[model samples]
Target chain A: MDVRRRNNVVVTGPEDGPVLVLAHGFGCDQNMWRLVLPALARRHRVVLFDYVGSGRSEPTAWSEERYSSLAGYAQDVVDVCEELDLRDVAFVGHSVSAMVGVLAAQAAPERFGALVMVAPSPCYIDSDGYRGGFSAEDIDELLASLESNYLGWSAAMAPVIMGNPDRPELGEELTGSFCATDPEMARIFARTTFLSDSRGDLDGVSVPTLVLECAHDAIAPREVGAYVHDRIPGSVLVTLEATGHCPQLSAPQATAAAILRFLEHPR
Target chain B: MCRTEEDPEPREPDGAKDGDRTTDAAFSALLEDSVEELYESAPCGYLSTLMDGTIAKINSTLLEWLGTDRETVVARKRFADLLTVGGRLYHETHFAPLLRMQGRITGVALEMRTGDGGRLPVLVSSVVKHSGDGEPLLIRTTVFDASARRSYEQELLRRQREAEEARRQAEEARRQAEADRARLTEALAALQRSLLPAELPVVPGLETAVHYHTASPDRLGGDFYDLFPLDGKRWAFFLGDVSGKGPRAAAVTSLTRYTLRTAALHDADPAGALGTLNTVLHERYTGDDPRYCTAIFGVLEPDRDTGEVTVRLASGGHPPALVTRADGTAHFLPTPGGLLVGVLPDPHFVTATTVLAPGDTLLLYTDGLTEARTGPDRTDLYGDEALHAFATRLAGPPPGGLVQALTALLDSLGDGVDDDTALLALGVPARPGAM
Candidate 1:
């Protein structure tokens, strides 16, 4: 399998520079990193990729059995790393992909060095005095949300949105196309991301990790970030002065600066 | 009201100026009242949220629909707060991202939670308001009540689901019907095999072969043939077709086959065995649906000193037996005026005797062969003359080879031969020294 084509792997920046693999989470694809790509690429060889079922990745490569769990997504990460034959690389993952990075680093420890988690929650459902910021019913509600928005993500509307007649160049842009994935694949990814519990896996982290969270995020609260920080042996936590789950798009400079600072000085 | 003066160009039109001033005053009052009323009481709801989705301004119509006061909604609740949990998730995941990327999104369906805890389905369109320097400022959104349209869409979806389920059930039923037909055909074929001999017994100094062809698998064939030993020296062989097809005729054929074998073992005379069969069938079936059949029962007696088999066969309403000579000539031995068995109280069967000399073969068959249609129009019958000619051309081979060639001829007839056919051949081998 050509992992590069299967995952839609995009490589930018200097060849000899340190590698930073950026993985997007459940909703959008690698295009989510567009706002922060320039600043990080100046000093690092940044690698961006869409998971098998999302973005511009090959749709034929997606299978419900493989992508219904985070391990299947971790295989995609491991495949990209092995395809490029990179070593001691920094992996930056957003939202649900942060736990995916955990699984990949454990599966192939030699390929990954440091971990960067952006606004991630190991478990979205709150349980056993642990506040993951949602209930089991809420996750089901999110699935229902995906069902209600079926028309929004339909393939019929994709061409109309991508082919904006007033600005023909925008038709070629990847902005509107990033979030238009196959709805069935998106539903599986949603169920997998919201139902996953990776807090126990954090204790096995042997690499330097950065936990980046939004100061006022509705998805991942501050307590979840502190809990992740406390679980890892020597992990560092930084709160970006941003809102929402995506700090890369909401506050790109702070997100990029904090990442660059962590890359230059790990300790 | 102003009226035109009859005296043209004389009056200063004082009355007209006074009337115009009064009308202008009333129109100004009406415009002032409509400006705010249109914004507050429009048919659709409208709102404008700040960049982070804080409701900065809302019209009175939207507030009324949400069942909330201006103080509670304006600058207090975000746009997502008014929507149901599912709708909020849709807003954050798909609607917001698309709106941020494209600057505008339209006709998105969502459900808002009213103050009374009821749901109001609505379609929303939003556009971002940009500053002069192209910096992001706030969002302007319009909401329209879509209760009627939502119910109609629900109906369409329900109908679509019903259609899919019906199609799936139809496919399942068709598969079940096919499986039932296959099982029935298999059972019928098994039953049909039970009526025929598993294998022909090997007779001393005699080479024998037989073939049975069935027109349809769904219906059991009425044709049957068997060859078995009668005593230490002589052997009995019979080939016949019942009066009709299917299980009823098959029952009669089964009776006919067993009665002849039993009667032959009792009395080895060819005419005597057929007489017993005719009596048994006539006694068993004597009603409105009287069962009858056409048959040929023969006994083969071989001479140990010379390669000669003496054949004595009796035909009852059956075609005449064919004898292919060693001299490459074939002729039918006529058994004239043989009455159909089980038709009369004492149906007389005609007996024919022939000597199977070296390199000579005797063939017995049912009428399916002679009655088969031939020619381009399929209106002509392949009569006894045609079979005689065909048998003459295929005279050199032994009984097995002759049966094989005749089976191929039957296959070439294809759909022209619609009835089931049975063929049995008995031949004596030529002496090795003789030409």
Candidate 2:
């Protein structure tokens, strides 16, 4: 059967090796992993894809029924891995994808060997005694914010995650991240992220997992990371000294080192 | 007449000098009497209180306002006692301590108790008189009769409250308008949702998912999407954003949605389908308040045996589609330079074609995605490159899973996307032994 590659540059490594699929977070694609992925690809088969409604994914291929929940996305990982006949999967999901892996693993636990959730959040809004740290009102305000001004909120929030980019700020820096997903997709994604009760998904993440909590992450604070660690029993929790939501981007060397060590030792 | 220095000093006659001296003394006495009388007989009253709030002295003006006897009040009863029931309690609870600490309390309005038990409202200004050594002495107070002033203030307050009530009514009216708009938006959303399949109708050899989020109900966003039957062999679908937002925006969206269907029914030309919708909007809103849209209309014809979808798209000011392959590679299938719908009497839309091979997913969306905000350092909008990376991850998911992930991705954006957005994805299951 003849299959076509959909993107610009395709990297081919070993035919039969452990699969390391890299999933990006909000406002970024697989390219973000370019700095570290080359190292991982040397030993393992690397697979990467853009999320639907973003990157190179076909817009017509996106459906509310299919893309309404992140679990659907998790299934996509399994589908991609199955397509490659890959096993003992090491899926590294950043930010949102970090939790997406959990939901996917719950759907097909037999397929996944381990997960490295980088700067993850199962639930952003805190509950009573729960350290999501954000109040229900906070989430409501967030939703209100998105509803009122999609571009404006994006301009404000995207920086918090992509703070201190590798380079200097251009005048248009504030408006940059928002240009990725269509504003409409953003509304759907915002409602899903802020409104989702993913704590339930946390309990189901049973694989040997490493939850890397960023030190100064404004979005996923220390407390929520602790909660994620506590819920996934036997899951080792490590607070990465690196500060910011995208430690892999802000502090790549440290992030890569941590992931390499964790992958080798089953932390 | 010049008088030399030696001239006799000016002198008045005895009768004149006597009269001038008597006149000056009488004028000074008169001025003093009137000035003293003004303070004594002013409209308000003045008094002094001991540090303990014992009334030390009182003037006739105070007595008149209170309708009380100075003999019975001053040096006998405490100042707090001179207040009516509520005023006395208030004095003890709120006023007394504030005056003691601050050394002054002014403009405190209270009703004084008359001997007949009537209450007369008065504005009181009090100061804690201190000695040379800074030791607190008597409290000197001035009282102004505020009956007329209070009535005037009350009338003004009443008018203000009435105006506030009117303002609230206006707000309620505006809120109702918003609610009505929301209801209309809800109805439109419901109809729009129904127009698309609850699940993308499964054509053999294809896994499909689509997501559509209207920006808000405050204004009916001009975004609309649909997935329907073109024929037994193919499916018809389109997602679009009307140029404006509101009823007019929704109108154009509905027209686009319906016309695309009708055009596809007539003949499955994605370009012709969009062209018809464009024509309709052009004709309807050709007036000064012009409306336009950007749309991506496509037909998914699957080769069941090979498991491939030959996708043909017609774009009207829409972003290009993204194609992510089974092997984790992705790029945008550029469909650029399409004129906006209703941009001209006869606008020309563009068409692009791609084949969705097995183990691949295709993403279609309005510009809302790329225009999404990414803050901080990458302070530009979410661009095509980032999305390409996103699609490369999900190149292998089923439709349901794809929508879920896309929905989550959208959710992560929060307010980054301030526009209504729509997403459509199609990917094929892995054939055994492909890896």
Candidate 3:
């Protein structure tokens, strides 16, 4: 299989620069990195891709059994790395992808050098003494929300959203197709993302890691960010002055600066 | 109403008439109902929010529908705050992003929480209002009640699910029926084998071959054949077709085969064996659905000195047997004026005798072969004359070769041979050293 076409891998930067693979989280595709790409690509080689069943990636490659767990997504990361034959690469992950990076680093430890987790949460549901910011019922509510929006994301509503005349700044190619995914595939992804518990895997991170969290995120609260930082030994935690679960879109400069600073000086 | 005649005197150039006064009063009344009244009591709900989705202003119609006052909602709640948890997630993930990119979105379905804790289904349309320099300033939205429409859509979805389930059940039933038919065909094949000989017995100095063809797998054929030794120097054989098809005819065929074998062991004469079978069948099936069969029973005796076989056969309304000569000639060994077996109290059985010389074959068959339809229209019967001609064409072949040729002929007839057929051949080898 051509893994590049299957994952929609896009590589952009100086030819001889150090490699930085940017992975997007749930609910969106690699286009989530649009705001931070310009700054990060200046001196570092940046790689971007949509996981199977998301964005422009081929939908035919998606299977419910493979993608129902975080391990399958990590395999996608390992596949892209092996396909390009890259070594000592920096892996940047957002939301649920941050945990996916943790898994990929463990599976192929020699391929990845450093890890950058933005708005990362190892678990989303609260249990024991840990506050993951959501109850089990909230995840079920989120799945229900995904089903309700299925009609809106169906083919019937796609044309109206694609033919926007007012905001030409939002390019024609990226407007309607930005976050539109197959509804059934999105349901499986939502269940996988919101129901996962990767807290135990955080302790095994052997490489230099940067944990970037937003100031006020309802999805991944500050305590969940602290839990991730405390679990991984010698990891640096920086709280960006942004709201919501997506700091890259809400505060791109701070997000990129923190990542670049960690690459220059790992302490 | 008569003012025109009453005021017949010369009027002033500038004058106020009664019609003009009434029109002025009506216009003043229309102007009194102001824009604020129209906005507050419109048919649909309306609201305006800031660029960040904070509710800035809302009309009375929407406030009443939400069952809240301006003081509690005007600046305190954002548009996302008014929605249910599921709807809020949808707004953040798909709706808000599309609205930000598209500048305007219409007829998006969502559910809102009412003041009484019930859910209100609504359709919303939002447009981003832009400033003179084209920077987005605020958002204007309209909401329409969609309870009836949502209920209708739910009904459609329910029916669609039901139809899919019904179709799935139908497919499962069809698959089950096909499996049952296949198992029945296998059982019928096994039963049919039980009525015939597993393999024909070898008679010293005589070559024998046989073939049976069935037209349908679902229906068991009424044809049977068997060959067995009667004594030290004699072998007896029989080939027959019962009157009908399937289990009823199959039962009669089974009875006839066993009776012929038992009777041949008791009395070695060809006529005596068939006479016993007719008596047993007539006594066993004496009702309205009387069963009968056409059969040729025969005994073979090989002459040690001449290396030839003498065949004595008795026919009960069966087709005459054919003998193909070594010198490329063929003729039927006739057993004339015989009646069908088990049809009368005492059926007359005619006996015929023929000898197979070196390199000559004697063939016995049921009438299914001669009764087979042929020609372009398939209305013509392949009669005794045609069989004689066909046998004459291949007169010099051995018993196995002759039976093989006839099997191929039956196969070529295909669907035209609608009945079951059975053929048996006996021949003597021309060269004693070759045998």
Could you say which candidate leads in lDDT?
3
| lDDT, residue B10, model 2 | 36
Could you give the C-alpha RMSD of every candidate to the true structure, in order shown? Answer: 7.6, 31.8, 8.3
What does candidate 2's lDDT look like per residue over B77-152, in tens digits? 7786787644543353234533543455556666677878776877666766678666667777788787886677
What shift in Å separates residue B14 of candidate 2 from its native position after superposition? Answer: 57
Candidates by DockQ, descending order: 3, 1, 2
Candidate number of the best DockQ: 3
lDDT of each: 0.83, 0.69, 0.84
Give the runs in model 1 whose Cα sits over 4 Å from its true position. Answer: A152-160, A163-176, A196-206, A265-267, B1-41, B175-212, B217-220, B226-238, B246-305, B310-318, B333-354, B374-380, B389-414, B429-435
lDDT of 1 by residue, B1-435 (tens): 111122212223334455587766665565564445666776778788887788998889899998999999888888988988767766766677666666667778888999999989888877777776666688888888988977876676578669999999999999999999999889887878778988888887888899888775566788888898877788888888888888888889889888988999999887788889889999999988899888888888888887788999898888899888877888998999998888888878899999898888888888778888887655798898889888888755678888999889888888778888989988887668654
Q: List the residue pairs that clash in candidate 3.
A: none
At residue B163, candidate 3 shows an lDDT of 97
Error of 1 at B406 (Å): 4.2
Better of 1 and 2 by DockQ: 1
Judge candidate 2 against the unseen true structure and give its global Cα lDDT, from 0 to 1: 0.69
